[model samples]
Target: MFSPFDSILAFKTAIYFFLRSLLKGFLRRATGLCELQRLCYANNIGAKRTKGVEKSILLSRCPVLKRINTQLDALAEADELANNWSTVEEAVEATMVAKQINKSIHEAFIQPYRICLVQIYGYRQLIVRLDQIRGIAFDHNNEVHLVLLKNLWKLLCPDTELEGMISKQWTDIGFQGQDPSTDFRGMGLLSLENLVFFATVYTDHARNILSHSLHPIHGYPFAAVGINITHMALSLIKAGYLKTHLYNVESRIYTVEDFHKIYSYLFASFDKLWIRSKPNSVMEFSHIRDKFEAAVVKKLQFEDAVFRWDPYLETI
Candidate 1:
């Protein structure tokens, strides 16, 4: 498995980074600015600046800089959401002090660097909140869960009345069985929340996508596929594959609402792709889903990728 060419390429890459680090250190000494300050002052605002700041923090050897992220993680684990900004401000001050940079002279670097820190750490906080929600299994007996489930049905099927809680009519909306509770095992309440958000916020688009799922020949399980899309979105976020897109799209702090928007986009895009593929049957879902996911991942690899829902595309 270890070819000579592969070994040589790896060695070259390592040396390149080592030399680059040395150059950066020399430049910092000459310019009297830390790597983060230099990046903030040099790069344009938005994704490019944010991404550079993230990489700088990840690669920094300074103990204070390194502990900044660790402290943020600890705060998130303790559910200290209110103190995230204060913590970030403290870290920025500590970083300035550690590098012995006078904030009075380089006031411009403060806001840009702070904004990037907010985006970076805010993303981590969002992941923690999402994980907490995803861990909650669907409970049929819970009043709030029952209300959400019923609300989903009413939003999708306004005229149809439920025969009972376990009626076969549940399949009309694409639940695999009369009782939809069993389907929420993997993603838990997150799946339901995504579906409700899509239906309630983007009612027309949601209905249109649902109609496509009812296609006689190419019909797929709407609810199940939506849950799968939720899982895909979460996986990408956790893997840092969504950083570029989120950094570009979300100027403010990231939230569950942003995650839901991503899910809606994926679900709509999947529907469009599925129709274009003209599959022989629903059995081909796995193949088509893999191809769609690969395409999405490729798109997200770029520094400026921002996914948006195209309502007009539904007609195409």
Candidate 2:
């Protein structure tokens, strides 16, 4: 016969996992899980809650919780009954834990730079730098203007023909080199995304390299939403730019996932920013395109005139 103490202990333990599972699952979804596997997605986010909340989570799992994670482990153990038994218990025990831990196994191995946390300084200076970059890069004439801005417009303002604004801007700016689109695209010299990207890089590098002497963009609510390096890199690729600068050699492991995040954020999330402007079918909205291009050019022109564009550097 089972002793009363042993039976009581098992009952309490079961009740504990049961309530813990329910609370974790419910709480995680409410916090923006997008989608969660209901059967076994108590994202291991470590939490400290009262036992009463814990017990309720456990009591509801009579037929469900204990067996939820067993089959996968059991199948892999095929015929090794001894191993399968141990695996099943381990799986069940793990389910009692949450997915989002205060500390994670990856903690020991990965050192992630939460991109959102970094500080950006000096907007006027950043604008000056962007302008310097622009004066050199875009000061050329070609159908290339039409192409580069068109692609960027498609991303920044889809469903519109930005060719006119591109033409007007190039002419007004007195473009002098090879049109950036035809000469430096695909091979990665001066794509539109390059502006936002290299600005971050050069500014940071300049600040680091030169210490406080270098000025950074200030007072612009510049921010990156998530630690999605993959998304950033793909943004580079999708915008027809190069993926050279997103990471060091150590980050090669998470590169694919990072790219996916970049693709999702650009094409899927802020992509709508591309088409968010009010449409003026009757009135040529090309001027709005001009304003946007000018904003970009303004950013470029506002910076130091020294950072001239040389399409050749893109290839090298």
Candidate 3:
């Protein structure tokens, strides 16, 4: 049961919302604030009375702003007879002001401490591309549910920097809010281990969308490797640890050291990550990891040299 205060606040919220809608739609009216105050009073929401417990009874009798305007036409016309006249401008101003106030009231009723959800999605591409591969492909719009994943990616990575990296990479792939289970409640979202998952799971459409999501600009065939290495690097950075790795291109492995010198001025930020898959991301990482497990593995070790030696890596 809501208190009278709650009812008034809800009414205020609705009125203000209507105002915002009117503004967006460029709609106008011929009403004013006192009329709104009257509407509240008539709905048993104002200074005089209180004691409505039935939602159906209480809400059914309440007048909507639109209806109120229609009902007040005769009274407003009478007012025009008494005064000079009026236009829709007064009504619009009243509604808009009410809307802003209602927004404030609504905000006041909300709980503090806004929360952020970190959602992670599994392999869709690897699943689609390899029709033979077996794995889960989340197809539902709201399939993934995440309250918090990995402490908002806290560690060596600055909160903001980690946030940027997460947003740039995984955040966009995430599908949140869907309950994954058939049960009454609970979201269906889950994560697959990077490259392996990508190579073995994901629907064809999921695969395409996942690829596009990762590299909306340039489709890095090796994006998976880059993602894994980046996550590994960020993890290490958070733990005050480090790693060394390589960058891959077209099945060729080049030491980060080589590119460090060539793109030293540019790829310096990734100095800690080793840029080796030498593919780019999880998909690339999956392939490179299998083909070159003998060579790559966890060789991408990091140390103080990762940042002290290369400034850009520190930003990542």
Go through the candidates in order and give the C-alpha RMSD of each one to the true structure.
3.0, 21.9, 23.9
TM-score, cand. 3: 0.18
- Candidate 2: regions farther than 4 A off: 1-136, 166-191, 195-316
Candidate 1 ranges beyond 4 A from true positions? 1-20, 310-316
The whole-model C-alpha lDDT of candidate 3 against the native structure comes to 0.29
True-vs-predicted CA distance for residue 131, candidate 3, Å: 33
Residue-pair clashes per candidate = 0, 38, 41
**Could you tell me the TM-score of candidate 2?**
0.18
User: Residue 300 in model 2: shift from native, Å?
Assistant: 27
For residues 1-316, could you state the per-residue lDDT of candidate 2 as single tens digits?
8899999999998887777777767865786331122221332111111112222333444343335324432342242333334443443344334333233432321112111000001111222233333344433454664454444334432344545543533322112222434333332322344423322333332122222111132111011111122234333333422222222111222222333233333322221222354343313234443444344333333212111222224211
Q: What tens digits encode model 3's per-residue C-alpha lDDT throughout 1-316?
A: 9999999999998997677556534422443223223233344221111111111112332343344344234333333311322323343334435444353443421111000000000011111222221123434333232222222223112233344322443433332212212211121121222322322232232344344434544234232233333333323322322212211111121222322222222122232233432334434535543443322223333211222232323443
Q: What's the best-to-worst order under lDDT? A: 1, 2, 3
Give the Cα RMSD of candidate 2. Answer: 21.9
Worst lDDT run of 10 residues, candidate 1, spans 307-316
Task: State the displacement of the C-alpha of residue 268, model 1, in Å, after optimal TM-score superposition.
Answer: 0.8
What lDDT tens digits, residue by residue, belong to model 1 across residues 19-136? 9789988998899888888889987666788989988888777899889979976776666745667887898899889888898998888888888887887788788988988999
Task: List TM-score per model, in order.
Answer: 0.91, 0.18, 0.18
